[model samples]
Target: MSPFRKVPAYCRQSRTPIPFRQKQNEGLEALNTPLGAPRPGATRRKPAERAVARTIESDDADSLRAGRRRLGVVLKPAAQARSRNKLERLLEVGLEMMNEIGFDRMRVVDIAERAGCSTGAFYQRFADKEALLEALAQRFAEKAWTLLDTMLIPERFEGQPFAVVVRRMVVVMVRLASAHAVLLREVVRASLRDMRTWTYFSAMRDHMMARLFEVAGHYPEVTDKAAPGGPIELAVQIILSSLISRSLADQRIIAISDDDYAAELATLMIRYLVIDDAPWDAALSPTVD
Candidate 1:
């Protein structure tokens, strides 16, 4: 989590990670989304119709090479059509229920009912209700990593002012929290009892700091590779902490919308960096660049 003077470069592999599985997928028809649902194509076709049919037949092979679903946190791996469909339905229903009624009150039976399945079917997929949460957390981490890969590229902010960069970064994080509000809140709650939950999201935090430092441009370049950290790095820590605190706690303390929150955070960081008449302060105001 410590900030470095030089821009940090993570290998492409580090940014987007999926669960590891050793065994390859069997060419189960249900696995082809065979049970998931069919695409729209009912009528007879032209000369290439035969070719297309051959391609459809090859989907099982494709599944062997690619299309295999990444089964995260499920105790029983599903490859058959009936079982795969049930597994998919359970996860969909469980996520919806978790979103609707907090995870604490969501029941396996309730999710099964909504998915038009029985409790036995749900049990066939997950060991317990908590397994559903771990699945969601795993999916959230996948999405979060992809989001960070796309969102935190400093190159995207090139030619923009550092102030604008800060505001954009704040806006992105606020919107991310909004989109995954339920998962994030649960992670925050669970993190108190088990700090492991925090580890999943911490990389995003560290990535954001590095991105901000890169976008800060040459205005306040850090020379000390060694750190109690540079002023800008420390300032970013405060800004990021403030945003996280707002997301999980003290919601009643502020009444502003996400837009206003971003504005305030960006303003806070800029002002802190650009304090008046400070002999040692590295001002990041618009006047600097």
Candidate 2:
């Protein structure tokens, strides 16, 4: 049986009234009456009433933005360029302030001041500092990926030894980490305390590992066990562990080049993945279907 029923015509008519003279008359009366207390010649809104009047008159984001813009308190770019320019400027200012004051100490007001706007303008663009930080993290990650993509050439791997492929991949990762040290440091810190950061890193790390396993699958000579316990696991552990260790060690040593770390890590990984003195076909037999 149907639980819902159509309303009877009379019930519908009673619930939803057809607007006529009653609403029209009320509207006309409102327009004719003075909003505040009427005076002899001029209707003078009281001081409190006047403030309320002004509040109601300009009670919107656009109005507040316009007011600030008119006072030269904010930058008012065209709508087409507004979002892009505002976000870029916020990230630039936020990062600088974060570096100087630390993330927790940096306030939205400080960011707004650096941005040459008010707190209202900053809030209009970002809900809070964390949201702004997330945007910066995402942008930095994208830039890092672009750097890695440019350095890693898959075609170079086709005829070369697996050792060469491993070298190039590790070198690229180290270089990328070097290029974005500030971003990486902040993201790592944020990832430790922030759930959103954890989710992003976890997904990105898993996806990259998944791709490595897929590529490893193409070369059956590489492994017998499933990743990340196979050849790919050794590579992943070497790359991540060495990168982290080198970053910490460099703070003490101050002369650790990414190339040196890459070369060393790459050699170790190659020693692990490559079979010594065994022919490729003999070393890894295709699993029988």
The TM-score values for the models, in the order shown, are 0.58, 0.59
Q: Least lDDT summed over 10 consecutive residues: which range in candidate 1?
A: 280-289
lDDT for model 2: 0.60
Look at candidate 2 and tell me the lDDT of residue 69: 27
- Which candidate leads the pack in TM-score? 2
Q: Write one digit per residue (lDDT tens) for candidate 2, span 115-218.
A: 87788877766667767777666666555455444434445356656555566566667776665555556666776787675454555556566655555555
Off by over 4 Å in 2: 1-79, 99-101, 146-156, 223-226, 245-250, 275-289
Q: What TM-score would candidate 1 get against the native?
A: 0.58
Residue by residue across 1-289, what tens digits does model 1's lDDT show? 6584444333376764332221123224336655546533545567699899888997687656533443334244455677778776887787788779888999877898999998997776567776666566666666656665675566775655555655666566666665666777777787788775566677666665565555554434333321337776776678666666766665677677766776676677667666321111112211100
Candidate 1 wrong stretches, greater than 4 Å: 1-92, 213-233, 249-253, 275-289
Worst 10 residues of 2 by lDDT: 280-289
> lDDT winner among the candidates?
1
C-alpha displacement of 75 in model 2, angstroms?
A: 19
Task: Quote the positional error of residue 126 for candidate 2 in Å.
Answer: 2.6
* Models, CA RMSD each: 23.7, 15.5
